[model samples]
Target chain A: MSTRSLYVSADTPVHRLTARSKIGLATALSIAAFVFTTPIAVGIVLAVAFGALAWAGGLRNLRRVWFIVVALFVVGFVVWPAFTPARGPTVLATPLGSLSSYELRFALGRSFRIVSFIIIGLAFVSATSNEGIVRGLRSIGLPYAFCFAVGTALRLFPTFLSAADTVRQAQEARGLDLSAGNPIERVRGYVPLLVPVFVNAVRQVNDQSMALEARGFDTRGERTFHGKRPLAGRDWIALALATLIVVGTLVGRYGFGVGAL
Target chain B: MREVFTMWRDTRMILLVAVVAAVYAAILLPFKVFTILPGLTSVRPANAFPVVFGLMFGPAAAWGSAIGNLIADIFGGTFGPGSLGGFVGNFFFGFVGYKLWGNLGPLSSGEEPNMRSIRQVVEYVLIAVASSAMCAVIIAWVADLLGLVPFSVLAPIIMVNNTLAAAVLGPPLLYLTYPRIKDIGFLYPELLADEELSAAGASRRYVAAYGLLVVSLVWLGVGLLVGTGAAPGTLTVGLVGLVGFVLVLAFAIIGAERLSAILERAGARPAGRNR
Candidate 1:
């Protein structure tokens, strides 16, 4: 059930970097992406990142998680205008109708910014396991409770997704037409599904807590994690390169004006 | 001795609650087909489950429901202005439910909520109304505090809409769903009685659910009373802020037994049976 097209390309240099460095590199890229809202700058960074993904895995990873990026982009570009009081930079002109140039351009740039981060997130998931991230967080002195919650959430995502599927199917077998109903009818249809899903979630949490206790989860005031992935030299170098890419963009934005990007 | 409440011997109940929680997450998710609320809308019905769970299970259930809400938000596409607003709003939403149900009882497995009594129903209404008012006030204050949006913009509409939505939606949802809660594993009567021998290491989440409800409600009351900077919300004034939380505590405790009946159907609770 945990199986899927892995976001992390196998045996790649970026994939091999210590998760700590990767997270740092990813954060730097995100900062650069956020700052350089200029279309040209965003386009170039997106292209470079996409190229890296192609080289590491294939066009496949990009295709698989592209939906998330697109969703974020649309929300920032389209939904924000309607909801927020402040209007975005205008960018277009329509002689006959209501569309304008300024608002359009600003939306496009915002879209680019969000999509760029999604790619960064993809880099995170594709390169490291959830355990790696958890250990990295704990080692870096994040609260045990917080880190544990994250780890459990990630670890259980696949399981929960699968459990959901199982229950959905079981309900369907009992005359539940999951796909064909009005929104209200469908919500009511979900009654059968909710019972089992929550029962399982509660059961799992209880099980997980017990499992942790048995493994001495709360035995000592401090806890140590194993399976620490070491930072190979190649991994560090890739990380440095990633950092430089972002730093260059930021420096260009604030120091040299938008043109530097 | 109290820790023994966690065992799950009844396979069906455990299976049911887990499945219910998962499905509950799916349904509340904004992208989920059944989303009744529109894009960026805060009112949601699926909240009753976690509220019930927290009241039944304790603080963890509160956290779980909160997480579930966040999950739904992210999957629906991370709404930028939404991140903090949604988190706090939903947190209090579930928190109020937990506070109502969790602490009012002695917060132990054997102790029941007197569900058969209409007094419990009154308690539920009081808890629901008080919690709703508190939530509405905090959401408005916090929204202003963050400067993400202005009170001038949001308060006029939200103040009225939220109060009505919470009071109306919260009680019916609880009433309809509360009856089914006993079906969950840890609360199974058969297993609790037969497996009392394994009670030593059992988890007290079930008990804590009730106890923590009382404690958390007090926190909510204190927050509401102080944050409003006035008195109980009315017409245009909305929630008025108070200085000390004494009134808030009084509201929670005085209404404590009258509201937040976590121990309903005490004999029906399946405390030590959780495997």
Candidate 2:
């Protein structure tokens, strides 16, 4: 019955910020990460992202994605240098060509930029609940139906996953050999697993639609929500700080060339 | 495309959207550990869901697949700025197949969607390839623009991954479920028949849209090759790719709007049952 999500329950300020504000802050940090081209600037953003995740007690979840993070870092570091033009003094020689200091530095900056993106993404999801995501998006003027669908999907994700597992087990019990086939046949083995789940889903849709109509789901009017709260003063402060960081980074990069490679 | 927006008004369509999303994410989540490219994409048998569901559920599948992909990314630990591309890319992965099936194939004269006939099967494969390419170009272009992954590398990989899954799993799934869904009164065309009434008269426009889609895809493919193949940082190459990207968006939006006009006209007709 357990659902998969990245949200970590905590009482820290990072988690306490309204979902909308957190979304805004995460967006701002992401934009700044892309704008800054220097290793130093990108490193600062990465540090801030990591620090924020730690503050929210969401760092524990990093274990799940450590492989991806490490792989991205390694790929960025290696690939960018290979493509980059050799410039400045020679740092190393290879069969292909000599590596320059500038190429090495560019590689370092790109690696940090890529890693920063994942950190910011993890931080945002770790602090915001699925319901909060829907509410926040709704408050920002998305259509109610779309938001409802998104929230419903999040809730149903776990149910369906569990159902797929059950269907697979049942099929196995009935002597379905999923592993004893060519690649294409192995994929075809998914037919039984997929069909039953989809059929059950269609049946649920019919009943669910009836329930929705009975609850006046199609009615037009202002609707009230549970757990709705006004944006607090602390939310404003968080938003302002995020704005400042983004604006400052852009100004430093474009106006003064402080973060350029 | 018009139904993509109008379906929001129907409670059942909204519910279908949720169901599709849940099913897609459920199928996609287990494969998260098998990363073909970390933080970009993974080995995806679930890629077939979008095509089969799109053919069955229409616009609901488009929106649902988009949301489902986003959910997979969030839980799979791959959510990032590139997720914007993934959302749009997955939307079209579902959208293009449904939109093109009856408009461009042997079924273009308004035959019901099926996989029994050889011509119908060929048409299904073409639809799968076109949709897969559309998804790959959009995602790889965005990833390249963000400097995350090169188009030359990611585009071909995604195209093959998606097309293979769709070609392998799509027809059988459709054959199994299409008749049952139609019987249950949940088949998208029947369920939304009122809104899609003008579909008969709009075939030419649909063909035109498909043409523009093909042109844009070609433009993007050529531009990406030229941009990345020559001097890596050439200004003209960048401009070529940028222009190509803009044309793809422009043509896609224009085509959707044209189809939406058809729906608007259909809605203006007298409220009566034709079925």
Candidate 3:
């Protein structure tokens, strides 16, 4: 099975940064966007995210989500402010009554916030591998078990995708017309397909468990790993910058009321 | 808690979690419902994973659901900050289901569901409803606070979608797999009950589940009435409903226990088997 997910590897500074620092920076920037919803705050986050995207060579992957982002952006620009009650002093052209400049700005800010989030996410996933995710999460003080579970899930995703495809093909061969129904009917058509797939997956759980145990998976207490990359000064700098973004957003919003939209 | 942590770390359990997450994400990613809102919420039979996997693998399933939702977000083209919310909320989606069933009635010993008892069936539905509400409340609260969507719009949709999947489809699936997994000696939560439940804790969980059911029903009513223009004040009603929902979930999750003893004492069942 192909190990194809959202991940794309490129040789760049952001990509060279450990997964832990990338995750930290992206997560903090995303959270800061949420915490401070003003245009200035969101713009700052968006700029950083775009910088990361450029550095990580994630811009190429933007094609995959362009349609979705554009659709959401249009909706946010047009519909959200029309529905939102809050308004500013200046009035933008309201084809319908009572749309204001503030609502438009706010809506624009929101769209930017979402776009920045998506960019940061794409950058992180593009730079990091399944192993990187497990190690990074473990480094950040998550339980080792949780980290393993995350890594395992990433690794198994392609296998399950293939299995689902095989099940769909088999059902199609059996004359299950999953393609020829109305929307609701089409969804209902999936019931038969899903039931068999799920049952098969459930059945394999026991054997899989047995296999793991036989391979010394049950061995506990003080385990050693092969690829343990300790954090370097560069990683610490990234962490500090991420932490500063979060802390600065909070203090600015509450202390000085600088960026509270 | 220590024993449960060990279960998650066990290699076999980790594999089980991985497979569960992967399958669920794969099934849901392609068919996602792209809303005007910018996150991954889909018309999912994949919702079945948390219910089934939770029963089969315990805490491992909770971790799986969390990671699976993240993976689904990435695949569905909506991975973002909201996914942090998605991860936590989806974890409870499985955790609540597992915790609710693991110690309830005949399942207290972690035996396979025989489907012989009406009370157990009702309990499953109650658990489904409460868990759905729990997920909807937590996620919508964060989303609304961050100005994604109003609580009224997001909560009802999620609550209805999840409950319909779990209630309509979960039991038959659970029944079908129970015997097979038991035969294979992989029916999880096999450990005898370790936590000593005080009566108060048990009653609180019962009350909480029941309260959540009623409050959610009323919240749904308010949503319907408002949608049809029969009622005004949606935001007010929605905010109120959200508060009530969160309070009840606290009771359900934090003070959790089996409701079998209470139901039997209330004369719902004439005979209590194997007490």
Best by DockQ: 2
| Lowest summed lDDT window (length 10), candidate 2 chain A | A1-10
**Alpha-carbon deviation at B217 in model 2, angstroms:** 3.8
Could you list the chain B TM-scores for each candidate? 0.52, 0.81, 0.69
Which regions of candidate 1 are displaced past 4 Å? A1-6, A56-58, A65-68, A71-75, A79-101, A179-182, A204-208, A238-250, A259-261, B1-31, B34-54, B65-93, B99-275
State TM-scores per candidate: 0.61, 0.90, 0.81
Q: What is the interface RMSD of candidate 3, in Å?
A: 4.1
lDDT of 1 by residue, B65-159 (tens): 55555444333333223344555554555445544443333422222333445565555555554445444444554544433233333443343
Off by over 4 Å in 3: A1-3, A90-96, A179-185, A218-220, A247-257, B1-6, B9-11, B32-41, B99-126, B191-205, B211-249, B252-275
Docking category for candidate 3?
Answer: acceptable
**CA lDDT, every model vs. true structure:** 0.48, 0.77, 0.65
Ranking by DockQ: 2, 3, 1
Give the lDDT of residue A239 in candidate 2. Answer: 88
lDDT of 3 by residue, A1-261 (tens): 122466776677777788889889988988877776677778888888878877777776677777666765665566457446666775755466665667867887777776777777877877777677778788788876667667767877877778888888898899988667554454456666676776677667668777767876743556687878877899899999999988988888899987676
Poorest 10 consecutive residues of model 1 chain A by lDDT?
A79-88
Stretches of candidate 2 exceeding 4 Å from the true structure: A1-3, A177-182, B32-40, B105-110, B196-203, B231-275
Model 2 over residues B1-109: C-alpha lDDT tens digits?
4567777777888999999999998988774213566654565678889988887788899899999988888887778898898898899888876667656634442
